[model samples]
Target: MTDQPAPTDVPTIRTLVRLAVPAVIVGVVSALVLFALDWIADIVDKGIWTALPKAIGVDPASGWWIFGVLSITGLAVGLVVWLVPGHGGPDSATTELIEPPLKLAVLPSLALVTVLALAGGVSLGPENPIIAINTALLVALVARLWPAVPSQLIVLITAAGTIGALFGTPVAAALVFTGVVAALKTGGALWDRLFLPLVAAAAGSLTMTLLQHPKFTVPMPAYTTTHPIDILSGLIIGVIATLIGLVAVYVFPLVHRLFHSIGNPVIYITLGGMVLGVLGAIGGPITLFKGLSQMSELIQNRATYSSGQLALILVVKLVALVIAASAGFRGGRIFPSVFIGAAVGVLANALVPSVPMAVAVGCAILGVTLVIARDGWIAIFLGVAVTGSIAVLPLLCLVILPTWLMVSRTPEMRITLPAPAKDPQTPSTPASPSPGA
Candidate 1:
């Protein structure tokens, strides 16, 4: 009999099964971290926006109070970045949703700043910082426990688990990781590669559900029937939202540069907070904070706002998102982008009244999310999620075609800082100074 070589690269079923054990652990731990951070943020948020205002006998919604809280929030976050270890873990505008893990020392500061931002009504979400935190913590812990396991695998599972926790569904993790796994150069069935991540994601999603149920969908009118005209309506809304997102994408770097020119975290971030306070004062409480609860409020009370009012809210929220991200806030853009998309959709319906609200909102969310995340699956997932209707699925699929083309070559809503120019007369210095400095 001729000798044959067993495939060395492909993992055995037994090997994968063993890995699943750690995947489950990673998932559960990741969810616990997410829950803890969110719990802390919620408590602080209530104190700042609800209890303290009541204690002071001031209306929480009053312009001055809103301005004061947001301005103080900026200052608090700014100090963390300037004096806290790890400088709040790099500029958020320079990072992606999934990047290389940060140092362990950085995670606490990142978490603290994220909590402060969320509590202070920053127009951002917890996605970016939380993912970074989970990835760093899990990668280090898993490496310590299982020295043979690859660090990259830990990063992937942690990310999947975190995503699952954030969305309350493993499906989101699956859709998001499809592109990630497809790019792998290994010899195995796609599902085989996905098995561990799916396990982790499922565990994370279930853990989050058991701890606190979160609903991504809103209570909106049902989208029961699909019509030929719905495609056109969806397309128009999607394209318009995409264009608006593009505007933010193009303007992001300029705003980032303007803020960083001050060259001190406390000064620039504090200035950013004051500006956000001004925006909050102008737009009222609805336009403040990470946009999830505010989005629900906006859609639920659509009847109270005119087209012009909706337009003002949309612009104000978009501007706030830009400023918050640019000015050193530790948060993600996805939540606020979703808010902006809902605003566009509601405003369209207010103007025309013929377009169904679900279609309008879903399509707009699909477009805006696609631009911000640069991932079609997340865009579609969030679009359908927001409207809570599969009826909008086909329409979104159709609308995404044109929206993708529009945004495919556009600048992402991130800042790309240039390498520092050297002065021939000056000696070079260390890139990063000590935390005590």
Candidate 2:
């Protein structure tokens, strides 16, 4: 492959336009793929949670049903991962939010497992695997159609598009990818560097929005007035939640290893399902799945749950997130972290009515997200999006400083980086050539 000029340094206006058109197409296609995956998962969720239970003559919401469905889901996932062609396309526990594109042959297994986890009541998100799938598929397609386009460029646009689709807005993708683009030393104005990717993200976000209403907003009282107490409460909530997430971060490795000790996907994943089933029985259905709809559900039905009930939900969901992530399930952590933060926010409002509802929720999200994702900007974006109140933005920006300090010195909630691969030609034991042999 030949090295080419950075898109940011393209010579003419026509070139920028040329790059952005394909990017827009990539974004639209990526968002469509995401929508298709979710549509399929939704159908499966109803079959398991509704049709199957009715046929079996059990209450769909019963603990027995939740446990039975989740365990069966786990067994199914375990069997596919163990026997499938590509081992489920890399353990999500070991990968970052975005990694290199997977080989195309691995996409189906990855997609199948991802849908299973979602439909089966697993407490993980689709972000990590979906991003991998889109990146790989897009890279391959672009290479076939326009071989001159660089692989890295396609990767950035595809990722940006998926992120935009996930958050239902181009802004989230922009915030998420800002640090990435800025890091490239190829020198240009940041937005110039951001141009093609942002175009793709906007297209993706628009497509998802047109397909369905975006879920970014929650029905909360408008954050109208601000007092010194608001900042104080927000900071306190942020600090406490960060500390809570840290416990899971530290404990994650031990739990991951314990499940891995089972030594097979069918075994470990099945065991993971059983643990999730028990937790589901304890926490009930609210603690299941990726937690987006559930997050809104908790807020919409806030009056139904006692403060103590909210606290239990928080703890149970936190544990479920850990077990699902550690136990070889194919999913992402961000949505669950958001759910945990939202739960924490609800609890904070119940315990201390003095704090504004939006502020409490935003801060809770900010803190937990900071610890789990270790991305300050994206954390702030989610916090604001949850509350739908820009009034809390400045306060959140201030509190994020302390939250970052808490997260900065801690171990990230990811597996240790794999050891570098040794070159096959490099000798395990260096030997000198026999003298003039």
Candidate 3:
């Protein structure tokens, strides 16, 4: 009998398990760390938003308390970024989810500012910092413990796991990484590379589910069936929201550069905090935090608000997101964008009750998320996730084609890299002597 040669395309079961086992452990650890971050942020949130307000006899919903807390949060974050060992790591505004891992020493400052931002009602999420911290930590750990594991593999797995843990599902990791991996022209089957990442993501997602993490779903009218009007309205909402989100994207760099030009961390961040505080004061307590709970709150009490009120909430949250992002805060824009998208949907419903709530929301989310995240799958997932209706998913899928057309060739929501700095040690030429001669 002749023994056949092994194929490079298909991985053996032994090889798959060998890689999958450590990935499982990494996923568990990532889930645990994510929980820890959330727990810590919750504790801080209670202290500032609940305990302190009650103890001081100030209403938690009052403008003064909101202003004070956000201002203090800004000041504290500013001090940490200015004096801390790592300058609170890289500015999240300038970094993406898959940027190079940060140093271990930088994680502490990043975590601190992230927690403060979360607790103080800063309009951002933990996605940027937490993902960087987990990826860096896992990469270093695996490099030391498992010498054979490639650093690139570990980074990919860690990222996939973190994304899984974050969204409470492996699908989000898969969708996000799909966009990432599909662009590569590597040899062999695509799943060969995605296999380990998917394994890690599944493990992380299962762990999070076992721990009973909340899923991302909003309360709205269920989508029973798709109609022509549904498609038309969805497209209209998607187009409008995408255009509005583009305005913010266009202004992002201008605002970021404007704040950065202050050239003093404390001053600029403090100023940013003040503006955020003012927004919080105007938008009320519902506008605070990373926007997850606020999104839920908006749904629960949406009936109480007038059309103008809903419009105000949408505008305030949008501006708050821009300020928080531009102000050098250590957080992400995804969750806040979700809130803004929801608000846009709610306002759309208020303006035109003829549109189904579920479809309006799904389309609105698809538009903003498509532009901001630059991933069609994630945007569509979030749109469907918020509606929690499978019927809405198809409508979202249909609306995304045009939404993609709007956002596909558009500028992504990121800062432009600065030019390389000149060396201070270089000697200057004697221009005056030459001119005299």
lDDT of each: 0.88, 0.88, 0.83
Residues 1-437, model 3: lDDT tens digits:
01211322344455666778878988888888888888898999999878987897889888888888888899999999999998899888888887667789998998899999988899999888888988889988887877676566677788889889888998899888776665553445667657778888888888888885767997777679898988899999999989878988998988999999999889999899989989999998888888877888887688899999999998999899889999899898888888888888988988899988888788898888887788889999998888899998888888889888887787778886885676899885421110000
Give candidate 2's whole-model lDDT: 0.88
Q: What lDDT does candidate 1 reach at residue 284?
A: 91
Order the candidate numbers by TM-score, best to worst: 2, 1, 3
How many steric overlaps are in each model, in order?
A: 0, 0, 1
- Candidate 2 regions off by >4 Å? 1-12, 424-437
List model 1 lDDT by residue over 284-354, tens digit each: 99998889989999999999998889999999999999999999998999989999999999998999889
Q: List the residue pairs that clash in candidate 1.
A: none
Cα RMSD, model 3: 8.5
Candidate 2 has its poorest 10 consecutive residues by lDDT at 428-437
lDDT of prediction 1: 0.88
Per-candidate TM-scores read 0.93, 0.94, 0.92
